[model samples]
Target: MSEFSELRYLCGSLVAVLLASILLTRGWRSKHRHLPGPPPKFLVGNLKDLPTGGHEWDQYAKMSELYGSDVLYMTALGTGLLVINSFEAAHDLLDKRGSVYSDRPRLVMIKELMKWDWNLILMSYGKNFTTYRRVVQQEFQPSTVAELYRPIMATEVIALLDRLLRSPEDLIQHFRLMAGAIIMMVTYGHKVDSVDDKYVALAEAVREYSAQRPGTELVDVFPILKYLPSWFPGAGFQKYAAIGKKLSIQMRSAPFKMIKDRLASGTASPSLASRLLHQSVDTGGIDQDQFAQNTCAVVYSAGADTTLAAMINFILAMTLYPEVQERAQRELDDVVGRDRLPNFSDKGRLPYVSNVVKETLRWKAVAPLGVPHATVSDDVYRDGYVPKGTTVIANISAMLHDPSVYSDPDTFSPDRFSPTDQKSEGEPDPARAAFGFGRRICPGRFFAEDSLWLAVASLLHVFAITNPDGRGGNGVKGIRWSSGLVSLPSPFPYKLEPRFSKAPELVSAAERT
Candidate 1:
């Protein structure tokens, strides 16, 4: 038979075997089997619902509505997957019982083929995880970030404005570089001198390739399929995995070597890597050095991301709501004056800009379904049995867009979060839902917030962003929110007009030491 036919034959045989096995064991199923979810295929269970190209967060959000909030249950190859759809459920399972629910679900592709099982975010709840979290907390504490990182963020914003003036069409690329440059300096003490720098390329590639998750890949569902020979049918995934493994190695090692060489030559700059090295002890293995390298790698992958999407959305929001943009400019013009750009010192005074940031995060949560977690042992919530080894997901999007929490949740009204606006009925600040819950909360949140605020305040002070094309915003007519780990708006045409006649000169002056 042809390879395609052969692959189909093998798949059919596997399904037959699975269905038979399921029938044989049907009578003695566990108590949790009664939990609610979409009816699974007789044998494959919810595997049919797996989204391949990494937009499955939307599917999970829809499943939440069907399953009726709280805890949800599904089975794949007899392994339980519980999706938490409500705030109470997420806080209860992921926060209260964090000891067991804090662990990440095993991703066979990332763990085996990509060699990223060592990722701090993916590692199980253990001493190493604790060390990573503690170190990140030490480095990114609010006081430390506010004290040290402000100038760095300001300089990058000035540099970004310089780029925005010269090539306004490439504003998106400038945003990416601004974020990447800040991260490179802070994480490794390495200055990114150009937009096409080697480290930038590597980090972007890693993020794109790593988007594939557990349910999205067929290999994750059928563990036995991994053992199948290379010559067997449908073996393309194995080849892809091999390529990913090599890329991951390069991604981790290149910047690490740059930092190590600088340290050896007595030329290292002050940064998280240099600081950690000074504090590291000889742990008698690859671990001590590995710890620094792994932490830097994670920061590199995540640093530019969460805010990149939101900053773009912030610009989009201005185009849609010109009146809001003018109000923010008036705030900036009043506090910062025309002599200098808005600095971090002016943040508290710029409440409107802060509200814009919060709304962007709430409007399109960077991660609709927060990182998948796993249960290490059996537990029960609301009389629902959460079996051991079950994969868990928190439906963050449902909460963010819930009508009850956010009246007119579909509308983009920044006043909803502004305390001074009397029209704004009191609602829980969406900022609570933006970062995350429990142990998995993003460590770089303070740093990211500072960076975003500075960017917004600075940008508002100098520029007027408007969309001549009216379809990009409103009550969500033409707005297209992505379903990736970060839910960013798709590209939309917008104007980048300077508010000041000397915009370029101001940018140049700010860029100078």
Candidate 2:
């Protein structure tokens, strides 16, 4: 035979052998073939089954309903993804199996190329994550947040009330500004004078960039592709990541540098950074390192943006159900008189207002599909095989909107949680599921809850939020729920008026100092 013909024959044999090996391996590993889920396309798996638009979480809830299982398993381009659509399943896997399930899946775009891997929110479960979490949670845990940060948070919200009173048209911006400024003060002891302030602007840019990211990019599904040069075809995500990396570094370094300077000069106000950085005399004068700095930056992305979203949802809820608003305000007024704004001390007496906060989360959680958790080893439950590397999600929206759990899942009724309100036997309360379940739950949950409660209770006490167009009475909801990781009530026109004639003087007299 000619040499050319012999070479062709050899190449064909190698290709056939490679194909057979792949087929054999997959057939041998098809233990989950019996697990029910959406039918995947040939070889492509469930790539086409992925949600396409802003309501990805909504689509996931629907998938769970159609499939009749809280845990729905699927694949995309060979990647295993389990769409968890129940609180019980979420708690079982992410909580009960915390030791084996707390690790985060590697999202190349956000964590690697974007350089956000340093943030504690996306850190892997290990010694590094454990140490960083310990530092960040010291100030934000339930006890410290109320004792050390409430006064500053209240002052920031009062400034928000002042802004809303002056420019009622800018309600959404006012909400964002309030959330950002509160975190800024608590993290860096920096006061944001205006929404346009430089640091605030950087944080705003970073927030916007983070929100625009896709749930999962192609590079994430195929990690090898991340190594491709930016000039390569379909490498646009890399360039996008470069832009994010720049913003992230600037966001962390700028404020950290300022704090260090002020601390050295003895001009810095009390802050998490100041306290965490104070040369741990016990540890022989330790210095604040990159770990702490990145965690502090996480305050803006994970903490500020999420609380802002919840507060925005609260306003939308009040606009849709004016009666709910009236009930919350009545409770606030009864417990804390109009002589001053609601304070941390008053939270204990304001049961209805607290219930309102819980209802807002249940109505439409800020991030409907809480952050994804990954499995560290292959496991089986209920005769189902869950392989390692599966992206496990906690479908909080499903838990919140389940008819069996909530009396009227779609309706905004804070009374569902009121102590005095009678609930049917066996009804499930979804309050704990709101923050998340288990080991990877949000560490800043305490601060977010308190910040949201203070904003909602204080605003309801002073202002009656309603739809100015009067369409709410016709049962037309005005606001759209967000589809992003950090979901906020989409911008909608609403009227904010003083609940009482004395609101202006009350707001002005309240402390902003």
Judging by lDDT against the true structure, name the best candidate: 2
Q: Using Cα atoms with residue i matched to residue i, what is each candidate's TM-score against the true structure?
A: 0.91, 0.91
Q: Can you tell me which runs of candidate 1 are displaced by over 4 Å?
A: 18-30, 47-63, 211-215, 229-231, 281-286, 420-425, 470-475
Summarize candidate 1's per-residue lDDT along 1-513 as a digit string, tens digits: 887677678767876786677668762254344467766775567767654454465566677777675567887767788877667677777878988888887777777666786677777777778878788777889988977777678778888888888888898889999999999888898888677899989988877776653235666655567777666767677877887888888988899899999999999998888887888643334376788888888887767877798788888777877887888888788888888888877778888788877777777677778787888898877767777888887778777777767778756677777554644445666766567678877888899888988888888888888777653445345667776567777777788878988766788887885
Highest TM-score: give the candidate number. Answer: 1
Residue 233, model 2: lDDT of 51
Worst 10 residues of 2 by lDDT: 279-288
Candidate 2 Cα deviation (angstroms), residue 422: 7.0
lDDT of 2 at 148: 84
Q: With candidate 2 superimposed using the best TM-score fit, by how many Å does residue 226's alpha carbon deviate from the native?
A: 1.6
Candidate 2 stretches greater than 4 Å from native:
1-24, 279-287, 419-429, 471-479
CA lDDT of each candidate?
Answer: 0.77, 0.78
Q: TM-score of the candidate numbered 1?
A: 0.91
